[model samples]
Target: MGKRSMPEVPQTSGPHVPVLLDEVIAALSPLAGKRIVDGTFGAGGYSRALLADGAEVIAIDRDPSVLPFAEALDQEFPGQFSFVAGTFSELDDLSAGRGKIDSVVLDIGVSSMQLDEADRGFSFMRDGPLDMRMGAIGQSAADLVNTLETEALANLLYAFGEERKSRRIAQFIVAAREVAPIVTTLELARIIEKSIGRKPGDAHPATRSFQALRIAVNAEFDQLVEGLFAAERLLEEGGTLAVISFHSLEDRIVKRFFDPAKGGPAQSRHLPQVETAARRWEKIAKAIKPGSEELARNPRARSSILRSGTRTVADARPTSFEGLGMPMVRGT
Candidate 1:
């Protein structure tokens, strides 16, 4: 994995609004003196809010560019906040010896900050490098598209993006890349759009393909799985874990994990008749959504779904990722 050259943070005219802000805060139920982890500290929105509510915040993000923003908050708040530059999947390591966390909040998926910046290559609306890395390091979306075989590319597009015409799109991309490597977001977007003809009321023919590519490029699903398990381990008994997922894929994973029926009775292959039970988390509330007012203000909030759970006072043994029963790309 190679890191991209840090570009100057461009002056953006608008502020990066955190989606489901009020809902996230209410679900988190931050209390003074309770330590909380803002797993995706993009633009420090949730972290700042938690700090304001008097909770000790441990803000974590993979991108180092957000460090200055978090650092500034640390200076202002002094001992109230701390920033760790790493993925939330490593929360266990980051929180080692700090005592069990009281609450953990993860606003999954790419942040507005990442999409607004053209140089980051997260959005097709802007012309930028073909990179779609959230951490800004590792093989980018371009690398995968240009190098993957037609079959692999098709599978990635279908599995990650949920594109119905993944085969056609992959064939078009593979043929186009033969002439020259796809290096920019617009070029790839055009290729996908052209392959899949626009529909009457479609927003963009390339939208789903772009999303699939970004999700694959970032390995978002894998990270989410790891982060969820890490949260289960980090949260103390009775601690809350709240997650707001922007898409069905993410929401499904969160929903299944928080469901009590998903996990079956554990049985060892050696012991054919013996069975053991495994339980880690308890669901707190049903799926939550933003109000119509929120949707009017930010259309992106329309698809967001919030789910929460509490760590139960059961055995704290680690469980297999398969046991969680979350939908994820195999071998991801």
Candidate 2:
């Protein structure tokens, strides 16, 4: 686990237009005097909006580079906004002793800021080190691609990315790395492209592999499961829980958690009475997608799905990652 050198100042850019902003706000309801947690405060879009509506916002992000943006928000609205540098999986501890949280809004997956910066190595569109680490600490993508066994690598690509040509791609990667370590985003992308020639109207051949690598590096699915449970613990009775997920994997986890009926009887009976923990969440809304206007303005919204639920009076129950159906990977 290597740390990237941090510059004195992080790159500042135009505000990110959050996906499903209006829809999320509407789901969260009555803002004034409420204390909310922006679980993934990438560009501070949700936090900024929440603060404008007179809510106390506790923003959370793993990337240290976003601290400058958080600092600017704190200065703009003194006492209204604050930030903590940590994964949303630890939101309960991060917001502990803050009293009853009124809402928890999570915009999951990679942010536009991470994707736009080539130096961060989140996207193949721009060449940089093959380091897809959201927290700036962990086993990087380069480490996994260069060392994991061929079968293991193929399984990772298939499980995380759902890449159909995983075997062929993994074989190519293993062969190529023998000559020289696959160190850059473009280098890996080139191997994938050569392994599976791109077809017309198809996305870049590297798309799935890149996604799998990023997900593994960040342990995103596991984090989402824990974060959901953490939100269940943090939110006050009748508080709102809003989640915006970018892909099916993320949306499935959120949807299944909010709708426990979809998932059968309690596997983890940590509670004395399982029935008491049964109805922890209520009024779970149907999934909401971005409108045509939003899609036109921000193409990023095309894959986003927003799901919400109201916390009930039932006691929050403890759960495991396996109970939440998160796929496991070595070193995650």
Best of the candidates, TM-score? 2
State model 1's lDDT: 0.80
lDDT of 1 at 281: 77
- Runs of candidate 1 with Cα error greater than 4 angstroms are 1-14, 260-278, 317-319, 323-332
Cα lDDT tens digits for candidate 2, 1-332 = 12212112234744367888888878886899999999999888888878887899999999988888899889988998989989999999999988789999999999888988888899999999999998889799999999999989998998898898999999999999999999999999999999999899998999999999999999898889899999998987899999999888788788779876575675566757545346888999999998897788788789999999999988887866544556555333
Deviating ranges (above 4 Å) for candidate 2 = 1-11, 265-277, 328-332
Instruction: Find the candidate with the highest lDDT and give its number.
Output: 2
Superposed on all Cα atoms, the candidates' RMSDs to the truth, in angstroms, are 6.6, 6.8
Clashes of 2: 0
Per-prediction TM-score: 0.89, 0.91
